[model samples]
Target: MKQDHRVVRRTAAALAAGALAAGALAGCSSKNQVPSIGYGVDAVIASYNGGSTLGANSGAAAVFSRVLTGFFYTGPDGQPVADTDSGTAKEVPGDAQTIQYRLSPEGVYSDGVQTSCDDLVLVWAAHSGRFTKAGPGGPVPLFDAASTDGYRDIERVDCQPGSKDATVVFRPGKHYSAWKTLFNAAELMPAHVIAAQVKIPNVVTPVQTGDQPTLERIADFWNNGWKLAPGKVDLTLLPSSGPYRIDSFGDKDGLVLVKNEKWWGDQPRTPRIVVWDGHSDLKSKVSDKSVGVLDVGAGSLGDVNLGGFRRQNLPGRGVEQLVLGTGGVFGSADARRAFALCVPRQALFDKFGHPDYNVKLGLGAGPLNSRTVQQDSVYYQAISGAGDKYKGGDATASQAAASSGMQNQTVRVGYLEPDEQHTAMVAAIGDACRAAGITVIDAGAPDFTASQLTDGKVDAILGGTAGMPGPSGSLNATDAIASLRTGAGLNFGRFGNGRYDAIADQLAAEDNSGTVLNLLTEQENLLWSEMPSIPLFAAPRTIGFGDGMENGVAGPTKEGAGWNMDRWVLKR
Candidate 1:
């Protein structure tokens, strides 16, 4: 999971509040001392939904990615590994397109509900887009999934309750490259919860158009009702389907998780885990030895000492890009391209990039970085030339803006408000664009809310999308392009191009590594001309820890520092 500046600010605020609360607790009573149980990790506890910004950005995904067992878990080497501990998914004998899955007999939710096929049905409904469209000609999805990759290919799902057995039939000739990674590691939540809340007659069958009344009710709840907070948590509704259960929560006190007694696997090394949303000051926290681990991020206490604690840089799997909202001032490709020229990428880096990392365009290409993309590829070579022509503050952009009839355009630039990094970056962009006779208006929002993206108010935004890197160096190139398509979940900019969509679809269908890379680079070249987005610098993964913490692993991907929390230990 990756995010923009708003997420970073939200995390800081939450952690700061938690720290204040911890201080208050200490002053109030003798029993207020930190618990001597499981090793603690600093995190921002936000919304619980796996598909939303709060889940993806605030490190809350770990509750689902690590605590709840998925069908397969992504290993340390960036490859999907089968999670035989939870279940087995195999191809059906006579049906090459269908896959069958059977759960481990010991698999059970924290509430003692046996893991069943019904849960898989819910996941299928959410990801398959079956319950996303409400009526004829409706453009917006009722339930917006995070990634509609493999699930969109599922044609049918047949599940038997109590048996924990199910079959998923894919669309004819639809070969999903990420099939193994789809459901293996995410919590599908419990089917019975939705069934009871929405008044559904049966929980095992695929939800269809006829069930819109009940399905819409379920979608509404799934979208917002499941949010978690200190005193506002609905424990009965958000039961865990994995190894740990939420024990308590608070706005300032932070969230706490305990080992599930019904967990069938090896007991977690730590008995209880306390997650502080914010510690007032990292330096003080380390000085007092109050925090066990600190999950530092970009622009958060840059290059601060850990008071003898260890520091390790993790593999970051995302990039920061400028997404042009094609519906407003940037409706013209020339306009978008001219504006891209004024994005002072280097200046923004000068303001924010520090001791841990530096800012570079990740090779003047698409959102795919050099880690998974070949710098010498034809596509990279092509886009690099185009990118160099702009290079913020260059006179070429000034002439281009004038020639393109955008010299005096007032482009509203939205970003995360109250974010120091975004404030500085936007200021630099304003200065650069003003030099080109274009005005950059601040239409920034508080956070990465969906409403802010699609309101058709802002002309452009400084944000990013999470990338999927493969063990074979094949980037899920289509994911970034797909976000610019019509009816795409993350297409907040209202940008769409039929020709680009056709090429992206082809790229999505390709499986060969070399072929995928070729198509990816080609598609990036095409998008460069359209300029729906300008690839910026790659986000760095740097985290700080407290003394005596060991084996604290930041997963090979951008899932975040908490992904491998179960393996972290404290040496006394």
Candidate 2:
């Protein structure tokens, strides 16, 4: 939902006052003394390409937000803010479906190559799902893109040879409201470098010619070439267009980023940033002055004892839920509903949700009621009441419902290993489901990946769905379509519903807010009735800022504290 402008102004004023009191308002006058600050992240970075399927983790997103500049970024008020320094996007007159993008004249990669139309075309081709190769079974997508929601609607991208501008045209009758999110810098790899790697004259030739073989070769490199490891990094392929570039990387020492000398924008306020894993002894490191900022889970706030650190609770863009598979113990809708009835959603929230954190932030201190919208959003509708029969661990009703081929059935719950929050949630589910004669097995794995959802290794998954709101401040229906529609890329639960998909598509294309709210109500009702997933509390994130660390605020999006890292100021 659209945040009140008054709240945004108040928050800004308070932060500015705090910065002045801490002497952090001095605008880099002491340039000779470069300040190096440590930033602890919650996950390990696997790749620099956060837009790829293999690199869709928070660690990669945090780093890429600093190393790459784009046309727009999520602002402090949770709305898109245009970045004129990188580029500008404008809609063509009388053509709502066409957008023209022009890169800044001074835009150049760290390797001194001018940013051009090649970069734009590369991102479009990779995400459009236009290129494919024959697999053992059939044709498979050449590029392993994370999600091709808005990009797949593009009719074509028009660009002049060697020009720094491009025109994107969507297919007739297809209008994407979230067009601003397309072609983020993190998705724009250096096309010149990829062309050299594939021994091609340029990337535009194959894309323009539709040469399948050449396109396949380029796709193969894009899929596997940019992966990051602990100690191994290829500098030639990792050029930065933003303010920073990777200087060093290690599993133990963490990743280091230094200012990009070739950057054309204003210099970054912080010269060097050291990123550490939050799973390590971050509290001790903060006390010892080894770490200066922390992005941690709200559940761990109780253990933090940093006296001078400023802690802020940021509402996450996702909701933790229990997703059921289509086969095995949860095959039937009745069985899935029974399992949802037995789940201790309240218990799980009490254990890990940190209600006090939300209450202090002026939000409801209870389990989330809607899957599509956050609790505090103005458009949120409390549809969970329709499933009141499943509230507060309804063992009797669950037992009665589980008697039909569901009694004594065992279901494995999969989650990422070493996650205290998920582990505790799984244990609670087991304890509550016991009364219904259902067995909940903990299938935690160290190397668990999203592939498990399709492999059927686990009957259900304890995970979350990203909850990005639309421009109107309501949960974007297109985002819901990506996760719940039949055969959607992010539909890990193998859920399929033609009716739900139709309503979601209509909601995405409709600009009328009243009609959207009605559609959302219908969508939530279907989700609760079908039990594809059980909605839990809204996920909570906390940011801890050490002394002299200014402008390091937590964003509501997945980027978290690193959303504005380029503007962060450190006073020693």
* The best candidate in terms of TM-score: 2
Where does model 2 exceed 4 Å of error? 1-34, 135-138, 278-284, 300-304, 358-365, 382-392, 400-404, 466-481
Q: Candidate 2 lDDT, tens digit per residue, 1-572?
A: 33322244336536755532223546646534338888875654677876676565324555676687777655544455566677888878545499999998999989998888888788888888777888897877888776677787888888875688999999888887877777764666778888889998778878988998899888888878889877899888888988899888886777888999998877888898888764455556666777777765555434557666676664565566777887777788888888887888777777776634546332335676666666666557444455556564775645555565677889898875556667777888899888888889999775665558667898887765521110111133234356676655456777889888787667656788888777777887788878787877666666667656666666545555666676666665
* Backbone clashes (count) for model 2: 2
- Candidate 2 Cα RMSD after full superposition onto the native fold (Å): 4.3
Error of 2 at 365 (Å): 4.7
Write the residue-wise lDDT of candidate 1 on 1-572 in tens digits: 32221233234334533321112222334332233323233233556666543444334444455566767654433445566667888866454477888888888877777888887777777767656554676645667665466677888777765568888888887766556766755446577777767776555643734476677777777767767767898777766765567777864445667777877765655656666543234444545565566544355443355655555543234445667777667778998888877777655544543334432433222323222233434445443444555456777788889988889889876754433455666777888899889998776654434345467767766654422111011133323544666566656666777776665556556767677656666666667778777656544334544444444544424344455554445544
Candidate 1 Cα outliers beyond 4 Å, as residue runs: 1-46, 52-59, 75-78, 91-96, 132-140, 206-210, 276-290, 302-305, 313-315, 346-390, 417-419, 441-450, 466-482
Q: What are the lDDT scores of the predictions, listed in order?
A: 0.57, 0.69
TM-score quality measure for candidate 1:
0.80
| RMSD to true structure for each model, in Å | 8.0, 4.3
Worst 10 residues of 2 by lDDT: 466-475
